[model samples]
Target: MDKIFESIEEWMRNLLTGMVSSNLTNMFTDVNEKTGDIASQVGQTPQGWSGSIFSLIQNLSDSVIVPIAGMIITFVLCYELISMLTEKNNMHDIDTWMFFKYFFKMWVAVWFVSNAFTITMAIFDVGQNVVNRAAGVINQQTAINIDSVVTSMETAMESMEVGELIILALETLLASLCLKVISVFITVILYGRMIEIYLYSSIGAIPFATMSNREWGQIGSNYLRGLFALAFQGFFIMVCVGIYSVLVANIQVSDNVHTALLSVMAYTVILCFSLMKTANFSKSIFNAH
Candidate 1:
């Protein structure tokens, strides 16, 4: 009877040990993959992410928005000329240099309207350059020490009884599922930002037309600021990931499995929430709204 009970206890311990180790390995693997995915996604520019969508946006801007922009430019130039004449003694004291200045402003307005897409893309190019450079450093800093974490986890599990190990295995499984859902949310946030950039690009010409006018230039100014905000929002996302990785990497699983697991889950939750706030934070810094 004593020998039989010993065998039973050994079997239960071994089974639970495998179960706990397997669950932890899977969880850490998912986290590492997700970190890599985020670094890749955040480094992409608007056009590189989906050329088809970019081409569609370009075509729509050229065919539909550019002509409307031309009309807006015409009206703005007329208003500018009228305001200029009115400001200078109601056109009675207008000099030759004043006419030249008006014509120069008109030429500049036309140039801005014609090259609207180029200007908008240049902003994103600079932003992408910054993000790409940051990605390398951020990726290195955000690497979770998966092997060490798993080894420590296994050692800790050796001290746990079968019942405790059973509970821990279940907890890890649940945490892994929660992480999968959080990964989906992270993807949504990244993709949604790109879609917003596309929408903003679609009507870019209209705002560029207004930029040369003194009174109406605020609209164009605000639009450009919003573009910068959107572009740099990726940088803020990368920062959040870096912070989350550091927090999770620092978790001490050998000391307490439950505490370590909960810390990881809490950090992931914080990351998602921080990601959602990045847009608002970027916009606030640039005063986009």
Candidate 2:
């Protein structure tokens, strides 16, 4: 027992030290320069390059491991939500049992996803598609000089045709709309996962909250039902994000002004709605008979 405690202490100390080192700008610069030199040298030989590339990938994974762990925690919460929904309700509910089952399933899913390189590759592929499509549009539409376009606009009073101005406006509008839609889709997927994790962690106490396992299960079930009720609320959030995106994109405000307004509106609306749902969910979880 003493050895185990000492090991844990040593592990925590090392983790904190590594985290502090990573936050230092000098450490990052050194790592970047070293990696660059190693990569350049490896580029000269296929055998050497493979080993160096593997090391580079391992280093990158080390840096991102914490964030990946957080994502796993979020997945666990989602599983708990599902588990709560499936269990049969009884007068003497065993919420702790359900929680244990949910957590086990969550762990299995996390392990499978982590081991499945194809899943990670598919996510990156989707990101690449979005980037490629956006770049293609920008290249096609903005091939000419922006200064020339502005100069033409300046002389519009005397020489500009209405059709040419309308065409330019439409093109810009189309590009902006395409980007906004893509942004909303990405936001929904990311935030949906975040909310799932948060709610699961928040409700995770039911297992330990009661003396009897049956009472714990009832609490877990109630929490799960509340999560289901919030599904519509989540959909509403996506709609709100879409509307907010369009409003910002179409507004003729300065970039800073547009960003400030959008940020304030989006955060305020989302935060308020999230809080409301959480409160209602908590009440339902605790008071449901």
Candidate 3:
């Protein structure tokens, strides 16, 4: 029984050591991958189910929204033209320059609607470049070290029991699952937000066509504002991940076995909770509500 307890204690120490390393590695790796995904998704459409959705939204925009926009533009311009002429007594008293002014406004409005997509993408292109450069500079370039954890618990592990080992195993499994779930949840939000950006951008020309009107123009303005918000949201997420990694790396585990375990358990809970808060935190940072 003495030998068995000794083995169990040693195994538990190893298990706990492995858990700390794995969690840190997985967390940072996920952060790196997500930043890459967010950067690449800018200005570039996706493939697979997301691609299919983009295609449908784009087709509807081109086929319905754009044509309707063109018709609306024509109607609005004609009304403006006739109104201008009538307001000046059917051009009898018209300032010849007013004709040129009306024509110029028409030209500018048409040009804006025609190139709304290119313009919106330009915003993302600049954002992506900034994010890629910043993220390259900020990262957890190496795994976290919890040598203190093992050093402190080294002697105490010699008397660990089988029941304690079982609990340790269960804790490891739960921690791993929690990390994976957080990674998946965050990845989905980043990708889904990307898809939504494209979908909203598809009909961008519609609201843009009516941009001279305050009420109608709000749609296009809000779309661009929202795009900028989502774009910067990724940067804030990078900040969160980087901050979390630094904090985890600095954790000071005490020399007592129970104390070390308590510290690790608390850290795991805090890390998971912090990661889960990142979406809302990032959103708030960028005023992305």
Candidate 4:
């Protein structure tokens, strides 16, 4: 019995280790591929392709992809809950097949936004002069002071004229708003298509399974309502973010404590508001259905 138990334990340990290692390997491979793609898009190569790819991927995943994924997941889960509640009320249809299709499309849209580093770079002009200076630095062809360049960029927000700052903020807001609008429209179309498919499939399976024209109209209305609610939530978050940016741009607190405290408070408030909005919106969507 003791020998058998010991062997079982050993087997379990190996199985667990293998599972973990496989997951880690897949994660690293994904990062490597994404980083290589980004590097190629940016027209630059790191010292060693593999090492640089890993580092770049790590940084991008940490700083951008993870947060975006979290937000998308949160939205998707909330939407699912909303669907469940509406289905419970028997107010509208809840087709799992349709839901899956819509969810998959939304996932694709979110992925595009998450991986949009090139779009961001183009919008912000982040590496234009930096690239030129870097080329010069590499070839020893120019005497550009790297430290001064860094300081200047950092200080630009502070020293910017009021009009210029406002314009910059507005531009950022517009770009984000445009992207979000496109995303929402895509989501709506995807959902609509899924619903059509579901209806057709049901009708084919059962001759009397077709919904009335009124029911179809109700579904359309409910979806549009949900879409608007989501858009409003996105707008609210963006406004908060804009305020945060302005605060960061204007405030030059030397004391770390003061900065840290204010930032924490601001972030906490934003988080609470966002959560409340998400929960309420989920309820609303469910009620609509």
Candidate 5:
């Protein structure tokens, strides 16, 4: 009877141990995959990230928005020319240089409207370059050392009673489920940012048309600042991931398996929160409304 009881206990222990190990393994895998993905996604320019969508947006912008921008540019230049002529002396003090200035401003306004897409893309290219450099620094360091986790976790599980191991197994399973939800949130942030970039780029010419007018230039200027904010928002996300990686790297799973797992989950939550805020933070810095 004692032999039978001992055998049953051993079987339960093994089952629970396997369950905990499997859960931990899956959780770590999710974290590492997300970390790697953020590095690559954040570094991609809009055109490089989704070429088909970007090409479609460009086509739409050229066909639809550019003509509207042309009319806006003409109206703004006419207003600007009138403003320039009248602002000096109500009509009597027109300098010869004023006409030259009006013509120069007209040329600039037309050029900006014509090449709005090019200018908008250039902003993202600069952001991509910055993020790529940061990515190289963080890519190798972000993966969780799951081997270390497995080694120490196995030894710790051996000393745990069957009932305790069962509870821990359930806990780890719950943690893993939480991680799956977090992963979805991360995916949303990445895809949503790309979609926003495409949307903003589509009407880029309209804002560029307003840039050369002294009275109305704030419209285009704020739009440009918003683009910069969107671009650098990716860089801020990379920084958040890099910080999370460093924090996770310092976690000594050998010290306490339960604490380490919970800490990892907590840090991942923090990472998601930080990534969500990057857009607003970047916009505030750029003063983009």
Candidate 6:
């Protein structure tokens, strides 16, 4: 009965390991075997993962966000009118210039509400241009030799001995589990940014409505700055990952399978931490505050 159970467990472990190894390419890889591991994967990700999510957000912004912004514009215009007309003696001293000024503000606010998504995309475009320039300079000097680690693990797993198979199976199981968790963590970061892009787009006009006022103009200014920060943040992240890939490519994995696996795990943990901090780091660079 014990042997039968072990056989079933081993089969399940094989399935899990297959799934993990298959998906690892999404996070770290170069499909073009010619291109060094880091550059290929880093460059590919902008168009690959969460890219469609960005498109979805853009569509949603145009369809749902613009109308909502129109309503906010209406309220703000009404409030501004009430304040300007009722302030002290403005009603008694109604002037032609005041009417012209309010008319201009209303026209500008309407334009802003209508074009919120285009403006949001334009900010992202600026950021993407910066990243493209940065990527143009990013190259891997040397490649890390991790193929041997996979090779060795595979060779060990092929052994006929039951005890060794059990041990290796356990290692594969642990690695697969870690990979699944890491995949989810990375996915959230990538997709979360797209959601943020839509959020910034949705209420975009509220800030633009105040752009004519000296004090309130800063709000629109800051929003654009933050949007750029979000867009360019990916560039920095890609650079970091590329550097990490180079480091990983060069790591000397010894014959000790456990040590090699542990080293890989350490690298992965550091990557996740670095990625999590990229948003704040890029925001600082753009002075989004």
Clashes of 2: 4
Question: Candidate 3: what lDDT?
Answer: 0.60
Worst 10 residues of 2 by lDDT: 38-47
Instruction: Please say which candidate is ahead in TM-score: 3 or 4.
Output: 3
Task: Tell me the spans in candidate 1 whose CA falls farther than 4 Å from its real position.
Answer: none
Candidate 4, residues 63-101, lDDT tens digits: the string is 755465456445544665566547655646656776676
Which candidate number would show the highest TM-score if scored against the true structure? 1
lDDT of 6 at 269: 73
Residue-level lDDT tens digits of model 1 in 96-147: 9989998998998899889888889899888888888777887777677777
Q: Write down the TM-score for model 2.
A: 0.23
As for TM-score, the candidate ahead, 2 or 5, is: 5
How far off is residue 119 in model 6, in Å?
1.9
Better of 2 and 6 by TM-score: 6
For candidate 5, write residues 194-251 as lDDT tens digits.
9999999999999999999876899999999999999999889988988988887788
Residues 144-175, candidate 2: write the lDDT tens digits.
23233233333332232444434434433443
Steric clashes per prediction: 0, 4, 0, 0, 0, 3
The C-alpha TM-scores of every prediction are: 0.97, 0.23, 0.69, 0.24, 0.96, 0.61
Winner on TM-score (4 vs 5): 5
| Cα lDDT computed for each candidate against the true fold | 0.89, 0.39, 0.60, 0.38, 0.88, 0.62
Error of 2 at 246 (Å): 2.8
RMSD for each of the candidates = 1.2, 24.1, 5.0, 25.6, 1.3, 7.8
Candidate with the larger TM-score of 1 and 4: 1
Q: What's the CA RMSD of model 1 in angstroms?
A: 1.2
Considering TM-score, which of the candidate structures 2 and 3 is the better prediction for this target? 3
